[model samples]
Target chain A: MRELLRVAPGGAVDLGAVDPRSTPGLPGREVTGPQRKEWARGQLTLIGAELGRQQEMLFAEAKARQSAARPVGAAAGGGGSDAAAGGAGGRRVLLVLQAMDSGGKDGTVKRVAGAMNPLGLHVRSFGPPTPEELRHDFLWRIRRALPPPGYVGVFNRSHYEDVLVARVESLVPESIWQARYDEINAFEREQADAGVALVKVFLHISYAEQGRRLLERLDEPRKHWKYDPSDVDARARWDDYQAAYAEALGRCGTDAAPWYVVPADRKWYRDWAVAHLLRETFDTLDLGYPPAGFDVRRERERLLGSERTA
Target chain B: MRELLRVAPGGAVDLGAVDPRSTPGLPGREVTGPQRKEWARGQLTLIGAELGRQQEMLFAEAKARQSAARPVGAAAGGGGSDAAAGGAGGRRVLLVLQAMDSGGKDGTVKRVAGAMNPLGLHVRSFGPPTPEELRHDFLWRIRRALPPPGYVGVFNRSHYEDVLVARVESLVPESIWQARYDEINAFEREQADAGVALVKVFLHISYAEQGRRLLERLDEPRKHWKYDPSDVDARARWDDYQAAYAEALGRCGTDAAPWYVVPADRKWYRDWAVAHLLRETFDTLDLGYPPAGFDVRRERERLLGSERTA
Candidate 1:
């Protein structure tokens, strides 16, 4: 039953075809076809099931911890311990995106990132840079939203837009925006070296998909508020945006911060793929309880007695 | 250092003065001194750093369980499985307030409730109830937001307002609103009998405290967006609202959903007290991991390989 539910109709897309070198602007090109295919097929079920299992286990564990009744600081190392030492010694993740209206950013954040601990996860949606943000560098606002140690921070639409959308629409001079790709690569490299796991996903959907979603939003009364007519103008720049994405992905697709060209034509597959990738990233972390040997009984008893007295 | 932090100046209020036998409409003779003091102390530390430690532990446990990579059905019995099995076995805490405009609901939620899994924790902030909500019953919206099974659900403000604010402000007739106390008591008794842990905290603050907060909002540019002059009308009826709270708390104070009048004069103290109460409630659960003896390795290997052939 689980197997049947897990396997989607289209199956996993070829990651190599979506690779940067294969096809610059076009969507389809297969490199390392057989090997990548075999690898993806071999790992898909195990990875999916493992992700689901982890989510459930995490929920159960959180519930149990709530019931332990231990003094808060006692169970999680000593008081004043940094979060990193309290069993969350993992590479922090930061997700950056540059999406047009009805570009599925909200859905991506919810479906891809919803299961994460709200405490350890930060979602910052950058509307527009402030005057202060513009005074320094464009990356300043983005820098402020970076996740702390052992946390994941997601940007709904990110600094890439200073090059992508701004370039496409001539929002900034070509000279000013063109240099950002290298600057971005350097900035991401710094974060990677600083123990931040970066997985940049571009929800590569066709103009047709964007149109269908926009229409659906209009049809659904609940989503009607989200519809904007100006999105049509953005849609007209489809080729320009596609070229920009290809260039950005090509320039910034380092071993440190690889870009995944997600086939977001299928929302379920996109969600599953993102979840699988996140699980893989977190699995690489060596998170566990601190080595136990602390005597918390005295503190616990004292606190309880104080409670009773109060 | 921990002891000094724990024993900081604030302590729970005395509730001894509360008389269970007291009839409704009695002026301000609500809570007994001891109970009031205990309640006060509990609220003071609801979101203190101590509580933050507990939250971190819960998340850490969840992360560990997830990392172990067990099967979903069986993994539910992993670390902290006791909470899953307990299934609504502890006290149901409900926090009530007038308006959370800037009354620290988000801060409280993050500090006190951020640690628990979303599955076992729920928050429902009642804005103007939908037409559908009002059409059914006053308690309809409130009941819908109650925590399921073994979990905690916090109400920014609660059903008491239908009587307190609506009565004092003449939003509803006195005869109609007055009868809600018995209805609420009966409802709470039903929850208590079913092992629902019920805690009601009225975050009390003087008009001066509120005025100071409002002034801060106006002074700070970032917070300017949050201020609403409409709050002055609510502040004008401060004395009337207090009388209503005193009456309602006195009448509805039961073993099931006991009202704890917390002093919100100090934000730190309130956060600490809430966390303390929550910790106390969960400690009573005696939760632990379920018995585990399942072979997951074989299944994992099989699943990993099956996708290749498909």
Candidate 2:
């Protein structure tokens, strides 16, 4: 599933070549309609539970590493082998989601990222740059929001906007936007070295599906706030945006930070795929609870008795 | 349920007077054991859905208020009546959780606030103050983490810790900690005036329960990382913490930010109470999607046809 969705590093990405409705890794695609949706949801719940457990281990490992800095190890020589320094190493995950309006970025996060404890998760949504943000380099705010050593950070519409929107809308000069491709790869490599495993996702939806979603936003009273007039303006230039995305995905894909193009037209498949990818990412982390930072026997005795430490 | 759980503003609190195991607002206390736990979990799922919907509406309302600043209302007079101006107003909710170790603060958040969209949610956990944080006023970091116009912010451990831990540990002089009660009230009031509705929850657990939980952390290899040796030290001073929390709850509870004492010995009840409180808080926000910012007829036409505005 991970291999199917991952954009090969330095490979040409033609958005038109892949079908947005494809459920690539789904078992036995013979089961269509409601049954498929049901299967995806069931799998998502199990995947989500796995994601949650991994995130807790990530947090627990950090806490162990941090508190291990205090008393026990130096004086008492900490009980077990890993007790002095903690079991798991410091490795963080950053998931970046980019898509067109109504492409289901919000929905995917609600279903996939939502499974993890909010404590170990930091979800940052970057809208168009504010006046102050515009003054700084585009990566300034992006860098500030990066997850710390133990967290799973999510950027909903991230720095890729610098290339995607800038190129599609001519927000910057040709020379500048074109140069960002290399700049982004370099920045991502640095993050990877710093223990940030980047999972960049593009929610791929067909043009027809986008129109349907936009119309639904207009039709439903509860969804009216989601329908911006400018969305239509953006839709008018859909081909330009697609070309920009294809170029950006092809150019920026790297071993350090690869892009995953999820078939977002089927919300069920999209949610399941992202959750599965996250589970796969964290599964490789070798995560586990640290050994006791203190002597287990001593602490147990201390807890049982209301007295001074041994 | 809100009234049952809320500690009255300026009222004295005696921790010993309340039973930590008592399930308030769970219909028919006669139904004991797993059935009651089962009922609470079922209610939680329903309440969580409501919470999720309200949170989305809160985010939508903010988006409308922001974009309502541009175009629409001022030009072409938007569409019809109320079309220029958004219907829903700006209101943010802040949930603060405080507890002794093993009081289920993390569990409650995973069960309850976990239901909301993480996009509109900002979960900030405040640990022991850093050296730089100590130089500033205690409320300094609290203010920095406050929810913005649209977000629903959460504080895993908040400024109340200044009173709880500082008083219990004697980290600050009696004079300093004594004066902080009013300082907290004033700060919270200011936040209330600025569109933040504070929902303070203290997950109340018995000393015996804490001991049981600590032992479980030691017994389970997967949970060893959660057990810090100092937690036993904290447990030794259980009475002092209870007194400190009692005083803080009484003094800090106000109409603007009331303290809810959730009997957290029962995990299901604690999760249900907090989720119920959040639903009731946002239920009063009168949340809804804003009126159409642009002419719906024109936008529909634009979406159907790939062309310029009408």
Candidate 3:
């Protein structure tokens, strides 16, 4: 299953290869050109349906476990119970990104983490640090956003920006930001050793695509409010930003927190790839339905007030 | 149309309400519940559908405008135009609350605003403010969370806490926090006058209900992490918080930003009511399909390429 979903060129598999028509259980057949687009759309629809089904199953199983007064171990995967239906009491996932802006961060979140139970999902979108944050060590803000056990916390532009953006714009001296790469790798290694699963995604988009989007924002009167001309100034530093990304990806791309260089020029492909990554991560946990002997129906009836007057 | 939809408790109407079972233009109808719950659910579903439709229309029209080199207003009120599609700009809404541990603010956001277009939605969950926010007025942290044009922003525990929590906990003196009611009213009034639509919902769950939820958190190992013993200290002051809320709502509930005293003892009811409020608010805007003759097909075709280059 892991090999089948490998991240390919363009940040996603060629949906055409699956040929939905030929692929059993999938919705569409493989075709060429616009049909490929249709095939991708159908696959997404199928994925949505399957996600809904899995969520319902998980919810039901979790409720059953709660009713049964099961031990905490039973809820986690250690007891041969369904891991997907249980909580990660000590498991953590950290998502790191560079500057978010409009470069597909929000879209990536919606597509990838949207299906996760909200209680198990945490999002921390970083901006300029507060006085207190600045006063602390540089990684303090990043450390604070780390997910608790059995949870996934996404950092929309993380501590890496301390090195990437600050270095690119010379906001900090070269000497300070240059040495910070090793510091970051050590920090991430500590987290990984602590049982945190960190996945870093770099959304790579061409300057032309960004400009086109910005232009669309300006052209629409309603969207005119979202337009900030200052973004263009940042765009002008495209090469610098690219170099910074390449360096950061090269330095920090370790087994602990492997970096996925995603071609984000195509929004659909980015969404698909991110969702695939998340599914793969969770699938590895080997989640399943909880053990038998729980009477969920009786508990549900009691909760719904079988004896109460409607 | 409006008269048919409006149901008086016992008054007679000239036209019958649209029958969900028999309506041809509408999709299949699911049983909506009874009384307030029914009203709430129906309104929420309507609002969700309407918002989704209008957002899709806006994006399509915006893309078309970009290609034609025309301002959005030129297409406005016509099919695909902003006005016709209910694409009013510079209208913002914010939801604010106070918190103890395990307050259902996150649940409220997911259930009420879950169907909203992510592009038009922003959520800011406030924690302990930083030195920068503390240096300024109490409202500084909250004021920053207000939505930009054509967007909805929700604040989970907002500026009101400065008065409600602080006054109750004796964190601030009476004279200082007491005067804040007027300050808040003035600020909200300014927002209302500037075309911002604000609805404040107080999730009025009883102390007993809160205790039950808290106990559930402790009993369930997965939720054990959420059980903060410190919340009991705050729970002791439930009456004070209620008194503060009653006074605040009584004083500040205006035509512009009315406060809904939702009976949140029932989570389902609370979710339904919040969604209803949003539906009513957006429905009042009279959003509809964009004006005709936008030639969306042409624009989409252009993007897809008219002929296969390969």
Candidate 4:
């Protein structure tokens, strides 16, 4: 199931070639309509429950290992040992979402991530860089928002926007955005070295599906607040965005953090697939509660004795 | 209770004159025995409840006003208007704590801050500067850790160490550490301008109390991990640390963020007093939920439409 969706390190992935309506893990391409959804729904319920349990286990492991710092110079990526210094208590997951407008990035967070504990999850939505953010290296703001140990961090849109949007919109010189692809690969590799389980999800939605979603927003008065007229301006350049995504997924996918191209036209399927993908990512970690370091009996006596009055 | 403990901006504060054993907010200094402990415990409970409630309100207000950015150039320190650009969602409290060895900072956090919502609280303990941190200006690391709007951030020890430890220990020459007192004041004033409410606490423990606490750590087997032999070296220079604290508290206290001398001989009283002090600080912010901007009726209809099937 994971291999079907995963973009192998250094492998070529043509975004235009992938179908947005296809569900890679679900059986029978012939299955359609409500029956298919019912199957997806059942899978989603099971996945959500398992994901929640995994999240709790990770959070518990983090607390138990709070005082333990990672051993200096742990081997980078692909250590056969189950133990990881960065993965110990401080290991975190950064779920980076990149897509064209109306790709349902925010909806995925609301439906899938909202099910998890807010205490262990941090959701940071990135828009245009602020003036202060622009002054630093492209990765500065992104680095600052990376989830601390024991957190599942969701970046609704991420540093990839620099290469994707910057290239498509001609916002920066080609020399710059072109260079960022390698920089991003290197950065993610470093995060993997430091005990970060990195997952990049490119919500691959068709151009026709995007138009429908955008129109729905326009027709609904409540969603009018969310409807940005600029979305139309971006839609005019749909082919450009597709090219940008193809280039990004192809060049940036590495062993440390591979890109997953999820078919996102169906919001329900998108949410379900993301939940499953996340479970697969977390299953890779060898996590557990740290052993008790303090003597409980001796401390109990001291707290109950003269100190209680003193 | 707040005024009794607060050191007014620019007011003369003699650390040597204050009694570490004195409970400033509690009544009847003549009171002793278990009765005094019970009274202190009662006050701590009351203060804890109030502090918890205040933290919730502040967090709620931050969500309500998330979209409302502080108006450009809102008044610094004191402003009569209820609407503040920075205060709309970004108002945060940075509690800077400075003290001598065994002065009970970790205890203060465990007792006082432990009562508040961990979701809204961030505690960063600064130690010797890393090579990367040293490359930047002294305030660089401090600024990065400031709680993003609507958080209560506690600095177990803060930038004041640049002056206090740097001066007494000669980690930096007199020429450098001497200049930081004014630099810190200006830096805090900038935070005030940005809608950050700042408070500085100097946990004032007498030399005799510090010795007792250090002795307790050694005698208790469970606490042996916390006791460092280096603490003895710092203890040897007790008077120098005291003089450094006096200068830091005196010079850095300002209208934007004043320093408070917290009596730390009695652990319960210290926790109760700091909790009370935080409640007073939060009360100053005019905070509430941001008004609902989306049309609830329209959103409900859209959710129920063909999109549910699509």
Give a tens-digit lDDT track for model 3, residues B133-246: 668898866665566444566766677777766677776789999899889889988888765778676666655566667667545544443333335556666667667765
Give model 2's DockQ, 2 decimals.
Answer: 0.34
Using DockQ as the measure, the top candidate is: 2
lDDT of 1 by residue, A142-167 (tens): 77656655456677777776777678
Docking class of 2: acceptable
If you superpose only chain B onto the true chain B, what TM-score does each candidate give?
Answer: 0.66, 0.91, 0.71, 0.85
Question: Where does model 4 exceed 4 Å of error?
Answer: A1-128, A132-140, A144-186, A197-310, B8-12, B26-90, B110-123, B131-145, B148-150, B212-227, B265-268, B293-310
TM-scores across all candidates? 0.44, 0.92, 0.55, 0.56
Q: lDDT per residue, candidate 2, A138-221, as tens digits? A: 898888777766788888888898997778777889999988999999999988987788899999998999999999988888
Best-to-worst lDDT order: 2, 4, 3, 1
Looking at the true structure's interface, with contacts defined as alpha carbon pairs within 8 Å between chains A and B, what fraction does model 3 recover? Answer: 0.01
Taken over the whole model, the C-alpha lDDT of each candidate is 0.52, 0.80, 0.54, 0.69
lDDT of 4 at B136: 88
Per-residue lDDT tens digits for candidate 1, residues B166-213, read: 776676687888789889888888877875666666566655566667
The residue ranges of model 3 lying beyond 4 angstroms of the native Cα positions read A1-107, A116-197, A202-252, A261-273, A279-310, B1-46, B52-90, B98-103, B117-120, B127-136, B148-150, B192-195, B283-310
* Clash numbers, per candidate: 46, 0, 18, 7
Looking at candidate 4, what is the lDDT of residue B37? 79
Model 1 sits at an interface RMSD, in angstroms, of 22.9
Alpha-carbon interface RMSD for all candidates, in angstroms: 22.9, 8.8, 14.3, 14.0
